[model samples]
Target: MTTYLPKDVTDGLHAARKQDMARKSRLRVEADGRSFAVLRRWQGGFAVDASVVPPLRGLVDLFEGSSPIASCLIIAAEAEDGEMHYEFKRATAMRHSAPLDFQKDDDAPVALIGQ
Candidate 1:
């Protein structure tokens, strides 16, 4: 199922972007020992600082069923209002042969992390 960003979340992400537009960068997302997604946002000090600060309750609660993941790259990040907007696409590491169910029209998902 395709999930949408909540209204509150959209606003927060926009605000975060405005607050630190320069810091956002691409991020590689991994879960259960597999690379599951990619997010070309949240790069520099902005992401770092946020990590150090208290986690947002709403942020933590958002995205039910979303795989818990560790990220590299900080990919993309935006903040608007009192929330954060994070956008990430899945990544296929080189180690895997081909992903099932995902059809390819001569285009393959790029591998973002070490296999």
Candidate 2:
């Protein structure tokens, strides 16, 4: 499903782009090991315009091509303009190459200790 991001987030993304030195990279999203496209991306979060099989609730990985960039939590999901929109928060690197699983289970969700 398609998601719409907040104005401030979009504005920041655009502002970053206007700066010449910032790394301009679009991310590919993965939910529970399944690859998905990041239709829109920013520093804070991104959106995927496809159905989240069984629905996503926890971690979502952001990749730059094959390299893992960040792992975010799927904080909220809702219908926007006849599509499911997933909202994520800034990711935490729990461990290198961790599966970035989104399952809410006994295991603690990956988080960055000491901001």
Candidate 3:
């Protein structure tokens, strides 16, 4: 026979699971100047709370805290469990330039030792 959990117990479990997801998620999406916390992410897609973000499509920026992670072209994939899922059509990682030190010049020419 199958057993069912009490309503309160099931609700508590759901709340706990949602909290865990939020805690583990560090990525956020920025679209149209609005930011929304990512609920879950994978190699090809991500999910966010439907209540927090409006219908979004096209290019969006993903960030880990203040650092940019990638630029993605996302298309609405589905909505379920209060979350909106998006599939990435394309994703490009943000590139950073190497730090330069003006005090040292390794390319400078040196005189011959014994000419």
Candidate 4:
């Protein structure tokens, strides 16, 4: 005989799976001093747990652990399946400075073998 799980049980399982994936992801979102785990991300948009924060809009920052990844303008937000998906009006990547070794002082004189 074939058997199927109840709707609530299946929903719970799906929610658990989403939570697990978010926990494992290094990506996170920050807005108004609040941080939320990213459920999914792409070039145009991202998703976060709806239970954590209220509906998001306007500017928000994306981060990979402690590093800033991008500045996104959330033009739209939709909540579904316990997750809030945001569509960005614009997503600008953060610029990082070069390593100390890679940077050179142009005014500094070069060393010579014999002077």
Q: What local distance difference test score does each model get? A: 0.37, 0.61, 0.88, 0.86
Q: 1-115 in candidate 1: lDDT tens per residue?
A: 8689899998788667644642342332333344222222343312223432333221111111243333322234565444344543432223224457866677766777876
Residue pairs with clashing backbones, model 2? 1-50
Among these predictions, the greatest lDDT belongs to 3
Q: Give the residue spans of candidate 2 off by over 4 A.
A: 1-26, 51-54, 93-115
- Tens digit of per-residue lDDT, candidate 4, span 1-115: 7689999999999988987988899999898999888989887798887777678889999999999999988965678888888898988889897547666888877886776
Give TM per candidate: 0.19, 0.47, 0.74, 0.78
| Model 4 misplaced regions, further than 4 Å | 1-3, 98-115
Model 1: lDDT to the true structure: 0.37
Could you give the candidate ranking by lDDT, starting with the highest? Answer: 3, 4, 2, 1
Task: Identify the leading candidate in terms of TM-score.
Answer: 4
For candidate 1, the per-residue lDDT at 6 reads: 95
Error of 3 at 70 (Å): 0.6
* 1 or 3, greater by lDDT: 3
Angstrom error of the Cα, residue 53, model 1: value is 7.4
Please report how far candidate 1 places residue 21 from its true position, in Å. Answer: 26
The TM-score between candidate 2 and the true structure equals 0.47
Q: Report residue 66 deviation for candidate 2 (angstroms).
A: 0.7
